[model samples]
Target: FSLYRSYFGKTSLEYHLQTLENNLTNLVKRNSELENQMAKLIQICQQVEVNTAMHEAKLVEECDELVEIIRQRKQVIAVKIKESKVMKLRKLAQQIANCRQCLERSSALITQAEQSLKENDHARFLQTARNVAERVAMATASSQVLIPDVNLNEAFDNFALDFSREKKILEGLDYLTAPNPPSIREELCTASHDTITVHWTSEDEFSVTSYELQYTIYTGQTNFISLYNSADSWMIVPNIKQNHYTVHGLQSGTRYIFFVKAINQAGSRNSEPARLKTNSQPFKLDPKTAHKKLRLSNDCLTMEKDESSLKKSHTPERFSGTGSYGAAGNVFIDSGCHYWEVLLGASTWYAIGVAYKSAPKNEWSGKNSSSWVFSRCNNNFMVRHDGKEMLVEASLQLRRLGVLLDYDNNSLSFYDAMSSQHIHTFEISFLLPVVPTFMIWNKSVMILSGLPVPDFVEGTSLDHQEQQQQQMGLCRQESPYLTGMKNCH
Candidate 1:
């Protein structure tokens, strides 16, 4: 029994030892794997450290290169600034040198100006000093005339002439001599007329005894006649008649040249010759073939034989409006009717006769409707109902049946062949003023001295007879001289 037990115990001890050996081998294997992993981790750490160091060194090298470039650029900028400063200093020095040279030139010019002023020649000195001062002012920006003021005044005093004294001397020289010839002025009435008026002013020292007038007429044929006359000292020629001596028997259609010579006791002066052509007379109406109402008088006045005879005469009904007229003897006056009514049933055209007269000195000739001669004086205006007006002068003699007013200022003026005066003023504003005997025609109202149409009639239609009647009524009511009558022609 003791021997068997000892054997079992020995086996058990061997198994335990085997198990311990297996566990020790597993530990050794695990520790070897741990060491290999640690070695790989260490190698990775070293590579990371080396790479970090290389990157840091590269960054440092790049920073040093950038710093070096910045230093070089800063050095180049500083050098450029120093060069600009040097150039500015040089320019300032050159400008200073130019100013010094200008000052020297100006000083020399001033010296020359002073030398010119020392001489007595004032004009030359003024010219030289002006030039020098202008140049100096331009060069040095200064204004200084080098001449002394006292010296310039003295030079002017020495050279200036006494103008007032010289004028007195001239006046004294003319005191003893004979006065100048009398001044004469001559003027013609018109270009184609024979009348001549002269005006003269005699010198205070001389007296004129007699005056003479001379003239010549050309007859187109080689024949020429010269006429002369002597008269007492007078301002106007006395008894000056037309076509008497100056243009005696002159042909109607011929042009003539005439001259006037004025003579005094001292001497005579011929005036400039004037050239003129006489107007030929119009064709005359024969007495045998003339109309029935027209009768020729010895004094060239055509008289109407009978007013009632004309009313029954059966002449062709011709339309006569403003300014149209018949033969000389027939004269018509408006009876203050409207122009349209007078022109009713009539064509566009018509005619009438006009007779005008100035203020008559003789007894009023009660031949026409009324004998109150209306005068258009220089300052006064003659107004008509048919919008016509006229201006008159002294002694305007209008002949019966001599003037014809057709329209507006269109009128036949009877310029007296003997007197050369415009004898009549006619109005043709609306209708012609002519004899109503031969035919029923339009006639114009003779506007006597009164207010203008615009002043009295205020309407669009100026020729309205109603407006004219209203105006005439008002005028008659206001004026004492204007007699309201239906027969005022």
Candidate 2:
């Protein structure tokens, strides 16, 4: 006993007890974890049962709807068949009655002829025989008319039922499934300044009940997955029956991405996305804002400097004074990118650009802080803003000039449309909406508004850093080599 006590000391006892306690704690933790897992599995089993029942009920409901439709159609077709049978029987019965009447009349004529033949006295026999013979001849001659015109072969053959197509349809019936995706026909799509008409085609059009169109403004992003996930900005139009849909009240000069969904009783499938853009805002010169000597023609699109032009009373909106020959457009632009072209038709001296509504109309457009313009005076080309001018290199043979105004980005650029060359760009932080302004000292200029921005011009816009440098340059004083041209208007 003394030896055993020495081997198993107080430390050994405590270590053994500690090991058992740790094992017990681990076992308790594992038991609790197993219980939680069991509870979750039981809950999942119950959910599965509910889902199964729900799906079965839906299946039955769909089947019942199909059956009900078939039943209604059957009733309608039965009524039609019964109506035809009644009409046919009525016609046959009338024909039978006519035949019976004809038979009875013939029998009576035969009896009269026999009785005339049986008469003993010669005179009585002669008179009776003559009348009877006449009666007999009339009855025999009219046999064709009295006979019923019933045709034995006229059994309701015309009204026979051919339900082969319906039988095939019924045999092919099955549970509804999602329709195939639709395809957007980009070539067939058209757009105007404020509307886009999206055209599409579907292979499963017969199965599809309706269509859903979704669109959102495109911001030059190529990641379609990310764009589709950002549904907050998407606009949805549902219950469309036609294959093509025209979305009105859209922003001009803006790009949009569209998607079409073919929907049925089961579900829906989306088409591949398509990108479309709208033309620039359409505008025409406002005659009310034309200068006194400036003549407008061609539906207010062409302007000319005429010496004998009719003079009118000047208003606050009209361009007045002897040296200012200008006009403003009818539309004011506050947002979105816009593009327009000017047909400079032998016009050597002209000014083209945008100006604020409060800009001074009595002075040259670009001579004040509220306007910006590219001017051509004799052989020199320059851009003027806020009483300062900068010489910009341009072709002397420039016949068509392109102007792109990006209001949201604060950019206004000019290009030689004939040669596709960039002329100049002005960066302005606009405080209000602006309208297209034009000035001419000789000849005429035609305005072409509502044009899409050319691809070359769109890609030629300066980058952020270059635009910053250019903006800084614009903020400086006028170029030293540039000199102010005298107002010849």
Best by TM-score: 2
Angstrom error at residue 130, model 1:
1.9
Q: In candidate 1, what are the lDDT values of residues 1-489, reduced to their tens digit?
A: 778878878888888888888888888998999999999999999999997798678767866886797589779877876686676566656555665665676578868877977968888878888887777667545322332112222222343334597557545532122223444433333322223233444443233334433333443333333222322211233233221133344333234454433344335444444444443222222233223433434443232333233422333332122222223222233322111111112122122223332211121121133121232222232333222222234233322112222222232222222233333333234343432221111222121111111211112233444443454454333233333422222
RMSD per model, one decimal: 49.8, 10.9
lDDT of every model, 2 decimals: 0.37, 0.88
Candidate 1, lDDT over the whole model: 0.37
Candidate 1 Cα errors over 4 Å, as ranges: 1-26, 52-60, 86-90, 109-124, 136-489
- TM-scores for all candidates: the values are 0.22, 0.68
In model 1, which range of ten residues has the least summed lDDT? 447-456
| Model 1 residue 171 CA deviation in Å | 99
| TM-score of candidate 1 to 2 decimals | 0.22
| Model 2 whole-model lDDT (C-alpha atoms) | 0.88
